[model samples]
Target: MKVEDITSSEQAIALEDQHGAHNYHPLPAVLKKGKGVFVWDVENKKYYDFLSAYSAVNQGHCHPRIVNAMTKQAETITLTSRAFHNNVLGVFEKYATEYFDFDKLLPMNTGAEAVETAIKICRKWAYEKKGIAETEAQIVVFENNFHGRTTTIISFSNDEGARKNFGPYTPGFIKIAYDDTHSLEEILKENKNIAGVLIEPIQGEAGVYTPADSFIPKVKELCNAHNVLFMADEIQTGIARTGALLAVCGKCDCQGHCERQATYSRPDLLILGKALSGGAYPVSAVLADNEVMNVIQPGQHGSTFGGNPVAAAVAMEALEVVRDEKLAQNARKLGDLFRSELNRYIVDSSVVNLVRGRGLLNAIVINDAEDSSTAWDICVALKENGLLAKPTHGNIIRFAPPLVINEEQILDCVKIITDTLKQFEK
Candidate 1:
């Protein structure tokens, strides 16, 4: 059925429930349109988009530049499998590689695919370059790390719901405590067969969990010392969502796109997605230098629609929008304001326990049991109050508005959030 034919939200939701796979338990807000920092529901009720499509719309929803690029390219050519080169792929590769200061980029459709690509490269590098024995390469990962839902990616994940029953899992991953430098170092030191350390610079799905200020850099330093690949899954925390071009870039003030500053952690392999196409397309990439990325040959690793022209055009425009808009600087300034405001509210309220995050990526921990519906309840209330947000876990509501959000909108949204929380305060 067509959207215009479906008059009620219930009917739309009912159709989805009946036919769609039960993979997600999303809030019942059926979004029909989006622009900038706001989205309109099926009922035409506008709300501040606090989630930014899980940071995929960092350049803002339906950004004109990105959309125009996609549409214009769509009218021309969209996909030409890696079997033959498209007109735009090489241009995008050069643009992206130079922009991120990497020697090469392996394009993919989603964050999970990019992650899998990084894993393949890392493992191959381990055998061919590092000279590790065949089938002995182990990649160190952290607890509560959310890379993707793929079988191999989830093999290292500790989340019971995502990991349960799905495996007779893949092996060669060693899990360690997150944010613990000593544990990471010890694991790398003790385990010589380790090929890489896959980590989220900021654990977004694990409740917007930002690590110690020094954690990322130290992890990179250790990975270097141990001759292990430091693969940063920036697919969520990247693209100016975390107050920097890359979350591993720390809080550097450069908005013209990262140039390997002193503050940058400099991962050996960088996985990026989500915001790469500004929610305009499914575009993700794994970037590395010659030594590491060259591990895989032509036939070994390529995707049918990975570097297609449409993705290439959309991604370039999306990245250009990020730089031209000074998204990193804006995210930094607004994030500080958001946390400061939310922090003040948390101190006085019984419903909220704390707000922790960097830049636009922040989350509030509800003062309720992990199993309680309090956070979800708060989000529903937020929806009614002209804002939209969702809980990451049972008690954690992540608030990651688009980097384009103005100061007034941030404050307005914060008011709506705080006012709603008061209803549940003890």
Candidate 2:
């Protein structure tokens, strides 16, 4: 029962199954270590990491630069709280705001916190600036959206599993179908009390659902016309996961230049997390321009560990890695190879109905019932074949590897996936 006795993957898996709170049903293999695109199980079996910690490790696992920065900061100072200033915080804020082209950055520790912060900022702006009456500001959200797991977040979620027994929910949220601009526009036009429209440029959780190319620009226009704040929850899609710096960049095919102008769909508020620290540390932030971010005077919304020194140091290095390494460019190249290779098999295989996504953030739709266990079965088979992936919905499995992945590695992964699918067919 001791750690030494657990020399095999099964033993480690057994220990977790017995002691841990069954929050997640992970694949049977027990990951002992990871570097770049590969992970080693407890038994020393190697497998390609395809999830990238839900797109949080865009710069790869345990990136030396980010880890070194974190270690250096840890040796000096890790946490000072927001009561006093930390050297790294100001630098991180300045660097991040400039990197994201935002006027201000409110640092937090988790993705959900950033989302909550964005929500609070929008509400404050609605009341103070937009003249919305107290307790009457509504935010328009999309169906099948996965913002976070906070009570307030789940309150607006349409997923039964996420919302069941989680209510009576938080109010003032209107839900509409996703990818339907007309539905959003109709709601916005009729609901004069709407304060903001919070959306994911590409829905990550319900599956990597990329909206139409014009969706973001049109939504921004609608929000501007109605004086409603346009907020983007780029927690999973940001940080170059979608081949762009942000999914809203409207340059799915381009690497450096965006097809749409920067001002075309500039969000009033932006929520970021996951890869902000390159999976080295948990660092998330809410970004806003002066007018929107200035609503919160002080003591309104804060977290004790929100802007810790370790997070600040780690985030700065992580973002630097993204820019210096050109991870976005790498993701764009590898992602095209991944989807193009998969499409060849998908055209002939009944097991896979479709493969859709941008950059490294992609998913495969299994040709099975929504409640079927086909995707899970495929994932288990994939694990046996030296690749690691997980099913998001019942019939959808997302395959988002680290952005640091190379062409040879991607082609190898494609072979693993195609070979595995062929076995399933037999």
Candidate 3:
């Protein structure tokens, strides 16, 4: 059907089902507008945004400052392709490099592209700098990790659904148990051709499985000791969604340039996306110091719209919003309140097993089998009760609202969630 013909929610879903790729099974909500932490459907029914586009809309939807930047830049210029330098790319590079404490930044348009770029950089750095044989460098990745759907990125994924039939898959990846430092260290020690260790600070797609607090620091130590590059895929967990500026900054108060902070488990290469533009544009970046970032010279890698004018402008303002509004602090404060309130309710809960996560990146495991529809049913109930959330895995529901959400809204969401789960009591 034509765009004008798609008037109702059912029509929209039907159009997507009929015309678009059958890739995703989205919840049945036809959202028309969003502001702060609330979204309204086509029927004008308002609901709290609990998922935040998988933490993409961390700064809230249609963030005014980011939107203004995007509009102002788009009027003048948009994509200028890497053949000719744009006016804003350098400024963005300098601003972001310094903001994240990286000496250089390689901008990309999506989380997958950034991950691919990092893999290329890591492999090249190993061959050129670490003296490894070409194409023999194996990057260590974790089980249950979700970097992106790209073939190379998925090469390391353990999810059968994401990996099966997507091959003959890319090789040269070493998989280890998630959050297991011993196995990671053993792999690094046993394999001299290992180039980098890629990981998510919090495995968001694997039901927000936050490793032990000691897990990341130990991985960092082992990587350093074994002289392996540590690459953090913070696309889902970074940019203040996890309370701190980055999930690696565990409980850190320093808002800007977290690498210097002691608690920060710094990675040799940092991959970020989703909220980098405050969900205004596709802006993903890979950051590293000169020693690592400089490995990729001209013509080695780039994108036509990687560091476009609008992306640069939008991303700069997005970072500014995170700092100016102290979204990190807000996330931290509200995260504590959310967990405490949820934990209080969980004491009497049979539907919910437990709550686990740091800051706002959290999930509750349903007391049901992995193949069960309990979590999905609960999400539908949540939508019906004036909130919107979705299950990540079979029986795990992730609850990550925008960082801009206030305490009162959080409490209200908590009530809706608890009330919904209460209905599913076995």
Which prediction has the highest lDDT against the true structure? 1
Q: How many residue pairs clash in each candidate?
A: 0, 0, 0
Looking at candidate 3, the ten consecutive residues that score lowest on lDDT are 250-259
Off by over 4 Å in 1: none
lDDT against the true structure, each candidate: 0.91, 0.89, 0.91
Q: Candidate 3 lDDT, tens digit per residue, 1-426? A: 455565689978887898899989999999888998999987789999989999989999999989999999999999888999989999999999888888999999999999999999999999999999998999889888899999887777888888899988899998888889889877877889999999999999999998888988898999899889999999999998888888887777776447788989999999999999899899999999999988898889999889999999999999999999999888888999999999999998888899988889889999999999999999999999999988987999999999999988999999999888889997
Better of 1 and 2 by lDDT: 1
Query: How much is the lDDT of residue 50 in candidate 2?
Result: 95
Candidate 2 has what TM-score?
0.97
**Root-mean-square deviation of candidate 1:** 0.9
Give a tens-digit lDDT track for model 1, residues 1-426.
776898778988999999999999989899889999999988999999999989999988888888899999999988889888888999999999999999998999999999999999999999999999999999999999999999999899999999999989999999999999999988888889999999999999989888888999899999999999999999889998888899898877776365658888899999999999999899999999999988888699888999999999999999999989999989999999999998988877888888999999999998889899889988998998889999977999999999999999999988998889888988
lDDT of 2: 0.89
What does candidate 2's lDDT look like per residue over 256-302, in tens digits?
A: 33425563377899899999999998999999999989988879999
Instruction: Score every model by TM-score.
Output: 0.99, 0.97, 0.98
Show pairs that collide, candidate 3.
none
Looking at model 1, residue 189 earns an lDDT score of: 81
- lDDT value, candidate 3, whole model: 0.91
Error of 3 at 351 (Å): 0.7
Clashes of 2: 0
